[model samples]
Target: MEFWRYYRVIRRRRWLILLGTLAAVLMVVYWNYTTPTMYIGKTTLMEPKGQTQDGVPLFQSQMMGTMLDPQLQLSNLGNIATSQKVLSNAAQSLAELGLKMDPEDILAATSVHPERDTNILAIEVTLPDEQEAKVAADAIATEFKKTYDELNNQALKDSRNFIEGQINSTRNAMVKAQDALRRYKEQNGVVEINQQLADSVQNLYLAQTNANQAQINHEAAASRAMKAATELAKLPESQIAGTSISRNPIWERLSESLTDLETKKAAMLNGVPGQPRRGPNHPEVVALQAQINDVKDQLSKTKSDYIASTQQAKNPVWQTAYGNWFQAKVEDVATGAQAAAAENVIKKMKSEMSQLPAKEAELAKLQVDLKAATDTYSLMKSKLDEAKIRENQGSSEVALRTIDPAHVTEAHNNGLLKLALALVLAPLMGIGVAFLLHYTDNTVKTAADAEKLLGLPVLTAIPGSKAHSLPRQHCPEIMDVAYQMLTSNLWVATQNQADNGIVMVSAEPDAGRSVNASNLAVALAREGAKVILVDADLRKPTQHLIFGVDNKVGLTNVLSGGATLEDALALTRVQGLLLIPAGPVPDNPVKLLRSPEMKEFVDQVKEFADFVVFDTPAGVTFPDPVLVASQVGSAVVVHSAGRVPRGSEAELRQRLESIGVRLIGAVLNKVRREDSSSFFHYHRSYEGVVMPQLTSGKKAIKSGPRDQA
Candidate 1:
């Protein structure tokens, strides 16, 4: 996998792995510990022989690619420790921990492993509880070492015993060679051989035999003597071989050393006899010369006798005996001396061997006595390794021990951010979804909503009938704002055309046209205009509630010849506004409104009123708004900003103008307050009545001090 893919796995499934791993770890910990128990234990160990040098620790060079599979050693340690025998021993030891488990069970619970290659073995045993587990571990560790040490000691002792056996034979052979050489040399004769002189040959021969025999017997002797003799002159065996005292170029000097010394002394004595600067005996040179001359005379006279005679025949026995003495005694003595030189090495070996057999034997016995111990130790070590492995796994594969660890909390992960996002996205999505459904929605949300779909204009939006419950007492500021808004819109609709001013207050059936018309009349009357509120909606006459007047004798009766126009016309409670309430429910209200009487009634009211505001049922329900709008000079199309169907605005306009009316503009109403928090409505009032802004903000001016008076 790519690193990022691994990252994603860690990112997305982090929770799964994290939660799972945390649960696993917690379980392990809980299993290992309970009751918040505190536990402590210490373990120590000494290095095995050869594993340490002078008490300094050393480890074998270990690396990844080496032939030594170190991981295998670790893995094996884990495996072997978990073996049945080790488990049993571990169980037995854990008895002190108050554990009642079988040896096998305890071993299964315990773990064993090496502390690197430090020859340090670690064992961990768990009990039913925390203190118990610690105690079990300590017991297992102690017994485990005992078991291992015994086995090692026993093995070492066995090896030492074997080495000791090999050493004896080598010693015996060494001694025999010494005795043989000694006996051969005692039988052989010693002769003084003078190598320098043409002298007694027999004497030289006997001396040769003695020298040859000594050479034969003296290999070890020579080696030992060579080691001891510093100047090389006093050596006995070498002397018998007839070597001169020193090398010299003079022919006379190259002869035997004794002869040379004697010759030189005689010459010195004879030449310088009585010619010394002092007395003849007083010169040190003369005295030394005389002494040497006398000794040489004796050596020459003594050796001259045999040097000639013995030179004629060489003795076979002496030759053969000399050869034997050289080979056996001499070589053997050399061998023994070399062997002796290895004393330190031998002693070291013995010392090591001395420790081995007992250790080896002990190891064997340990195998028998603590066989279960070995097994238990191995098991505990392995299990401990597994536990360590598990602990390692808990660190990364599980995100439990986080840099920011999670704790029990009332808040959720990313909760605040989530809530904020929902607060924003939910509404946005809701609106979008609402709009999406709105396209398929048949009900009206606004006049535009209806018009866009149905191609119609909406007439009057009846401000909902709950009067601002307490009027100014309820909220003057807000109601004033609404009043000003409606009036301003209507005033704009009537711009430059007040004659035949018809305000079509309409909706679909039950859309509250009466309520709309009455308030609009009140609004206009309060504006100082002569406004006539007419209940022209024959299908459902409701202007009576708005006027709070009797509907027993009104438009229906007047038109049907039961009353006159004067009797039907009534002054409403609102100033400058007149009401023409529909007297009663008419069966053919449409026909009555369409009659010439209705036209005459309109003409009459138009003469007296500055604006004729018609309250009509929705165009779809009744045709009064359409009829009046068609006759008027200008029409104010009031559309329920909301509530009206999506296409109602366009449809209402179409209906009004279908009979040839010119629509000045439309008044948008039932505008939402909370839902449309984005739009701000500002207001000011003249007493209880609301006065509309005459123009845009750019055109508005504050009244001067003089005008304020």
Candidate 2:
């Protein structure tokens, strides 16, 4: 999970990645060495520069004289170069030259690449023979040029024929339109009708002017009559009495009498200057007042009659005003009638002018047809002349000039590219496979593995020591530090337990359980503690060989009660350390290890020794290790780093836990110290000199308290 842990895996499996990469690259190299080489021929052709060939443009112009884009032209040329017709022609020419190559073969071996943004085509051909490659390339180029010229000539000829036919058809149409125009002019006797149409329009406008003047005059007359009539009708009856009321004789006579009587009444009421003026009913005053009342009554009646007669059109002044208004209305009606006649005349003239436009439209249509036909005929004739000139040019107008003739060269087998691909992919694949193996591998290799696999702390990591191979102890100080750490951790783990027995065992055989137990015993003994390492693996005991002790009498003899502890216990080369080797192979190591005598012996040894480490058989394969582990009551599982599978370690821890063995911790034994420094390798304090040494193969230690004791 950490970067360093992944780096460790890569470092450990670096050989595999290297081997895989080398193998892949070597395979590619071998293939390249064995593969056959091919010869390639190349030729280049430049595009036509739109130059004229004998008065004809190389790029033929259309009837409309429009030239194609250069890019489009180049694309068409490329297509023709690779076209089946050109390729087949090339094949046929080659066959004629005694080279019977199939068209498909030639096509397959040939490639046409048109340079982008440039009007150059590069043709390449690869074949077995160099000369054949050159010949094939040159032949294909020649055939392409020839086929393109032929196709271009055919297109030009088709264009000429089509243009000629169009020109003839247009000429005929132009002649017909001309004849129709002449006939129309003769039949209609119309040289120019615009002037006649203009004159008719002028006449209609003049009529409209006269009609407008008449309407103005009639409106003025009507307005004057209306004003006169309204003024006469609005006048008060008193103001019109002489003029308007005289028309009614009865009202005029009544008005005169009422005025005379009112004048006499006013004089009578005056009473001659100071008289009591008719205080009482004077006869003269009474008479005049009565006359005035009667006259007033008569005047009111006559005025009512006059007003009613005026409303009924009987008033003389109202009649005169009404007659004048009627006369004005008649004049207005007559003038409007004349204006309507003029409008009708104008409509007739407009109708005739609208017909003139039809004739003008006909004439314009004939003129347009004649002009279009003439233009088309002239254009087609010019295009036809160009086409004839091009045809006479002998297809040179569309011919291709070889910029560079075909040349032969050796074809690379693409080994360099293959090598490059291999070089790039091989390492990647190797790394992928390496990481795959690392992920799939379930072995316990580091302290993290111990914690992950068994949930146990790694008490110490004893790296692979040279002491195992040599008779003399020549291991680095890391080994000493590892054993010291192991013994110290064991003491700390078992400080609460009264029993001093600890069984060092592994999930499988040869997992450094014996070596770790012996080394830890020596380390403890060096601390001045009485340490005993008992080889309990009677099936395959290794402590006897490691400490150079006699296996003729050891744990087995003591457990069987055939010999006393003093006789079975052998002093090792390490001072203060005792070894009890597994005596001669037994018939039933499990029964022997499980005997009560074995427990008593372990208790007796614990009584004498400060610490006892029992080297038991592998717990996974043999039950003796489990029996010894149960009797010992304490366990230190020694797992060889990068060797023991975690699955087995987990299974062993589960079994030991289930059986009530006090598992102190696990020691990752035989850890290979990576050259890349780590915490374990940093303590190289013993690089200077040797302090003391342990003897191997039955030699008792000559130093330390062993000799003195």
> Which candidate leads the pack in lDDT?
2
Candidate 1, 21: how far from true, in Å? 33
Error of 2 at 517 (Å): 2.5
Whole-model lDDT per candidate: 0.48, 0.71
lDDT of 1: 0.48
lDDT per residue, candidate 1, 458-513, as tens digits? 33322332444211123344554555566666666556665645655444554444
Instruction: After the best TM-score superposition of candidate 2, give how far the Cα of residue 394 lies from its true spot, in angstroms.
Output: 7.6
Model 2 lDDT on a 0 to 1 scale: 0.71
The segments of candidate 2 whose C-alpha lies over 4 angstroms from its true place after superposition are 1-10, 16-40, 49-109, 126-130, 150-394, 408-442, 465-473, 495-497, 548-550, 643-646, 675-709
Clashing pairs in 2: 548-698
Encode model 2's per-residue lDDT on 89-110: one tens digit a residue. 8998888988899888998999
